[model samples]
Target: MGANDIFGVPGDYNLQFLDHITHRQDLKWTGNANELNASYMADGYAREKGFAAFVTTFGVGELSAINGLAGSIAEHVPVLEIVGAPTNNVQNNGSLVHHTFGDHKFDRFEKAHRQLGIKSARLDGEHAIDQINDVAQYIYETKKPAYIILPTNLVEMEVNKSLKDSIPNLFFNKEMNSENSFEQIKSSINNIENPVIVMGHEVDRFNVFNDIKSFSSNNNIPVLDLGLGKGNIDESFSNFVGTYNGQISDESVNKYVANADTVVLIGAKLTDSVTGGFTQQFNEQNTIVLNYENANIYGKSVDKDYNFKTIMTYLSKTKLDLSLPSIKNADNVSEIKPSNNKLTQSFYDKAISQFTSADNTIVAEQGTSFFGLASQKLPKGAKFFGQPLWGSIGYAFPAALGNQIANKNRRIVLSTGEGSLQLTIQELGLAFREKLNPVMFVIDNSGYTVERVIHGMNEPYNDVPNLNYKLMPKAFGAKEDEYDFIEASTENELFDAIFKAKEEKDKLVLIQVNMEMKDVPEQLAKTAKAFADQNK
Candidate 1:
């Protein structure tokens, strides 16, 4: 309900609906080059602005954007996907449409989307208002994506103006009977000697950063964030440890988490990527897990109404053993003395770590970009965006566009591999059209570096045709003075390019950093080995 912008590509079926969006003075319509990028932009906007929507035509358009919608679902982002369908009579009579399968069947797309979305609804003129309100409420409460099919004939259908006043409140009502669950959690905490708090993506999804900080700081407990939960907490906190990625974590972080007597996991999902190929060794019987809707203590389930925030509030007052061990910060980048002077992952990591600040936002792509930035430190108040669970490449490009739109005052730095950027590179034109300035670095590794490490080392399938990345800005309609394009093949060139980009604040800067195909992040190499073994 609080969404400020809509992203989509205009189509014949969706034109009428888009016209209304353009007429609204309070809302902005971001027209992307393609539907996939549009959905990704909406996903990024939702992650930053709390709520976002994207519109697309039925069938082809909806299917094209399905991958982005799937990413939002996997990551628990609240996005409303509006699909513009044919007229009511056309659907009622099963008439063939351009985007249809030519069998007069139009419901197949909605059926497929239901599996990926929290809920799917097709609006009917007679009950459109009721259906819209129900779906909106569900999306707000669950913080998940939802699909809505808007028939072309219903675009101009008028309804009671008072329906807008009936939108339900989005907050969850505190349960009075949660005291029993609180007592169980307190007993579990009291039984443990060294308990550590682990933060996850849900902590940011529910907007409870302050609550977690208060609880961890007041209790003097050490806090550790998972890979996906990067930038969700203030890393500068005295008790805040670095990210814990099971086997891939730093020696100090792994020791603190692995040896703890009791682990308090808050809003965390131990996915394979985040857990170093499912290498975590914690005992569920000694863990207290708190999520959005429920809590579990030492393998015992709490009441369904016992939310994470309420449990954190209770734990703030309850005293547990404060004998937890302090953890030192992990040095993500190792000092490298190159023998041949070829660009390496260490140089890229250090350069990005130096460029990032509290006023910036970093968007990393799925493969090397995601794994490489896992250990990089961010300044306080900085935001990080990535698709770890979905593992979607080319997501960060358009997502960076959306993030910039949502937070226009902050600078955006996007790190993506060349292989990943090719999928959604058309969004660069949209960035030019919108006059948004984001410093984008394309890691020209020659191919899919992460895939090469996983199963295709020296394989032809992992290779991609290299393109002249510096010419892309001009091709995207950027004036010579409106953008800066550079190629960095050495450490000094990379450093100078980034420094120059920072000085040119008013224009978008595109930097192509060249690296060897085998130059992969250390953590990604280990994770890839595990994946290769598992697949074997």
Candidate 2:
């Protein structure tokens, strides 16, 4: 079994661990003949996947290939990692070895891996062989990219017992709602007049979106989803206050949350994205944060606090103190309409028309897609998933595959650049094998559109080789009848093709959108320029 099929980490780690990181998962082991670890073969796999991959010890100047690997893995996707370690017992004998970097080298590796938040472990001691199976199971269950170091001596050790207890759980620990915690939360809620709920990824992690929504409704509090929590509630819901991550750019939504008298932040880190560098006009004294760890009422400092579930339930049962009028008649929201740029606006309109269903989910990148696509409104319940923290190119494809597997019925829309798609092209195979019926919308302009916009690159490196994206499905082994190929060069064809694909079911569609690198939304264009100038 390969990495995907490996039920536990022990089986997968033994096969691929302590080897050069392969760009393509297939290269790890494809059940094929002529399996040689040649440099050309490894490089071919890397280039095909649009990432840098090298042998375990291939150094490219001061920065080795492992350096590049560390940087790439930091962008949110979980990875399975393995490293070479010196035998614990033999290291005391003072032997100079090239195979092992040094004593405590794994510590440095751990620090580097922490940046990516990928879990890691060492397979070195006498118990190392015995514990690997449980560690492997933990990695598979969590979907987190992990690392397991293999010691030179222990690699040959007999794996006899299962070490299940040593395997760490990657999932967050929810705080218990004790009687004291509940009382503290109830008192805090009762003292507030206008309360706003700030929700974030914790809602998704705990699978408590519906519970939180119900709690908010019963308490008559408007919910402002932090950027990470953008799709917690359906966007069209009357109580929805809009995205608090400054990117939403709605003045009314911003003002409402910023001016709240009492902010009940549940499962949200009131981080920079939600607070705009903490410059928003909010009352620190009345701000309450209920996280998985602990609850704290902020007033210059923490005042009253408790556990997350306690406060949510307490607020739900209490008499709502918010004086704000019903937001159902809210007409102050700035319209996301067309500008003088007819071509760009129309392209967005057509793209929006394609995924008109509530189940449609769009995974976008920080490239021109985020700037251009966010302008177009999604269907009532459609989600826009992006790598806001890292803004990495290749994340969307693989992460989308994982998410699609999680929610197979939803129409997953991947709006990304031609360059970005190259990062994880191997995911196409995974999607094909899994029969994920997502619309692969390629904004094919044959260049790094986002980079050029921000840096004004006149270099040859900015351009990319043109790819025949329309043939992606067939190339990846999808049957002809199981897919729809739609290529549109103009606005009319684009609109028609998008609608047609939406009408068709039980088929994967590739809509090769002929967009220009220069056709960026004006607001985004300005922001990019301002950001560039400020840095310069």
Best by lDDT: 1
Question: Considering only N, C-alpha and C atoms within 3 Å, which residue pairs clash in candidate 1?
Answer: none
Measured by TM-score, the strongest candidate is 1
TM-score of 2: 0.71
Model 1, runs deviating above 4 Å? 168-177, 316-318, 321-340
lDDT of 2 by residue, 481-525 (tens): 888888877666766766788887677787877776677655456
Q: Cα RMSD for candidate 1?
A: 2.2
Q: What is the TM-score of each candidate against the true structure?
A: 0.95, 0.71
